[model samples]
Target: MSESIGPVLRVIGCAEADLPAGPARQVAELEAAVWPGSSPGHDPALTPRTMLLVDGAGTVAAALSLLYKPVPLAGRTYRAAGLSSVVARPELRGRGLGGRLVAAARAELAADPAVDLALFSCDRPLAAFYEAAGFEVLPGTVLVGGTPEEPLATDHPGFDKVVLAAFFTDGPGRDRAAFTGVRVPLHPGDTDRLW
Candidate 1:
């Protein structure tokens, strides 16, 4: 790994209301590129709140939107954090920018009093990438999202997602067994196709 770049990590905004007009366009552009065939302002889970990793020259090296929803499972609800549109400038892929951004997001989750855990889905080939970035792949585990009337699973055909997760709010999360070998109900809603 190159000497970890001392990029500036800042909270750009959390909701549409939080985004300053100046950076919102850049965020949306990055989102469209990272998550193709999707438009901005579609999912309620993807509140406009975003985080940025600015390189030393002040360019938006990487960006991602934060998603939050109360994940209910096994008679309990955990405040969960989800990540979307995580991307680094195409020219800057192997320099550790993406990993740095993810690490920072994890720190944000851990520091929040309400966020009990963080989870996201990635393609099978990207599982090792996330693992290198500190996310653990939950084998045989599935995240049930979408509407309660028509739930969607990460394992659904055509998606073949691998669930990556980390826990923070202590208590039950301290026990890995609680999350292993089970299907977790995430229910992020229909608009959040990647959740």
Candidate 2:
């Protein structure tokens, strides 16, 4: 799906596997630039879908990936999609492009009936940035990643993380209390741990 945000700017969405070579390379480069030392591609096992904000010149101005799966939380399962690898071109920071892209992604998830909620962890300082895009901090909540035997948590030492979520389904919204003040096991496996 693609939407025209302006005459010279547009936002497009596609499964990561279906992304063309040029745009995929651009997304990978943006990811590596923003997050040094990390692999420059999406984890196919995570069922990632790419969202890109492209300029008139076909340059990827901002990008983020959405990963979908069933997440167990508070003794129940919820269809969840997480926001990952959110980044913008280095020269484009502070221009609100990232935030706009985030908000657009949130809206896209909200429209998907299959998604019960959107949940992910962000660095403490970026909480406010995500909050402005319609995500609420799930206080005292920690997401446990990796396998159950080898887990990584947001609350681990040296990590300043905050769990943020947007409940899309009525049931999940009403059951919000079950999410807060608890540790939710995501177990997305070793690759892309803590996404």
Candidate 3:
């Protein structure tokens, strides 16, 4: 665990069975704070192959989940990593905890030979933050389940409504090939609705 200004960010590779209930609850709380209306299910724990936890003065500040999955993009087979459930405590925002957690996850993902690409979905406001972290924006529709929808928005049509936007990622150059101006596939979980 590495201590930051107020919290200690620890990257843990623990199975679902190993994480205690207290930490799990904290993770859920942070998730809810970040994404309203999203259910933080209790039964199936979020035990990503790689997880990062940020604790501020003994309290959970931020966390991220990473999973290695096969992603088919542009008719090519890519062993990519899915980054999900990224959240930071309301009081901890702008402290760089989110960026730190993401950087840690990226490093870990890059270490795995099978993980050639990393993917995640973020609202428009945070797009700049991700770009600063090395992710480049792509112009395309994100197919969620059976429907292809628009990019994430807060109001109007709401998150369920599709919008014209694209995915972004840190260009693959440091170790993996850079993905510039590439149309990659993004699976937003729901399978019945086509975006």
Candidate 4:
């Protein structure tokens, strides 16, 4: 189902076919507009996932990608949803669109029995925003590109040392913890910190 928060904001599920041909390019443009040089992955269409679009007055204002199923780690299996490519138009900040998009994404994930947790990376400043939305700061170090030296930075508050956060569908540790204290490699020089 879809939801409309107001005249300027409409939330709806979009299919892979609905995503434009150059989604990576489009996502790059959105990331650049908001965070300058961070390279976000653009492969939602290649995965078993759902895309949520937040449009403002018929224009694409924001987008979120949610991936379902287990993420295979070194020796463990974890059931979680991967959230990525969350973006909002540069001119539309502070209007509650981001939060609304997150809420909608969370709601969608919660309804799925296969998903036990939600995982994503965000720069420091927006950590509180996600925290307020029901995500808790997982204890551990986040290494960017498998190197702890390349720290992720952002203007969102309380996230200066955090590069990512994991939100549990049933609280922390009740279900398996995906990638606990694990390092996920990011692309080199891709510092667009918008998450």
- Please tell me which predicted candidate would have the highest TM-score against the true structure: 2
Model 3 alpha-carbon drift over 4 Å, by segment: 1-9, 41-47, 56-58, 141-185, 191-195
Measured on C-alpha atoms, candidate 2 has an lDDT of: 0.89
Higher-TM-score candidate of 2 and 4: 2
**Candidate 4 Cα errors over 4 Å, as ranges:** 20-28, 35-41, 44-56, 72-76, 141-172, 176-195
**How many steric clashes between backbone atoms does each model show?**
3, 0, 15, 8
Q: Where is model 2 more than 4 Å wrong at Cα?
A: none
| Candidate 1 residue-wise lDDT, 91-158, digit = tens | 77898878877777777777789788888888898888778767788778887878778898887888
The TM-score, computed over Cα atoms with residue i paired to residue i, of candidate 4 is 0.65
lDDT winner: 2
Per-residue lDDT of candidate 3, residues 6-77 (tens digit): 335555545445556777778777777777776653222222542545454346667766644455665566
> Sort by lDDT, best first: what order?
2, 1, 4, 3
lDDT of 4 by residue, 34-147 (tens): 767655554442343435454553466667766544544445455656566677777877887777788778777767777666766666677888777666655463534312
**How accurate locally, in lDDT, is each candidate?**
0.71, 0.89, 0.52, 0.57
Task: Give me the displacement of residue 15 in model 1, in angstroms.
Answer: 4.1
The deviation in Å at residue 112 for candidate 3 is 1.1
For model 3, the local distance difference test gives: 0.52
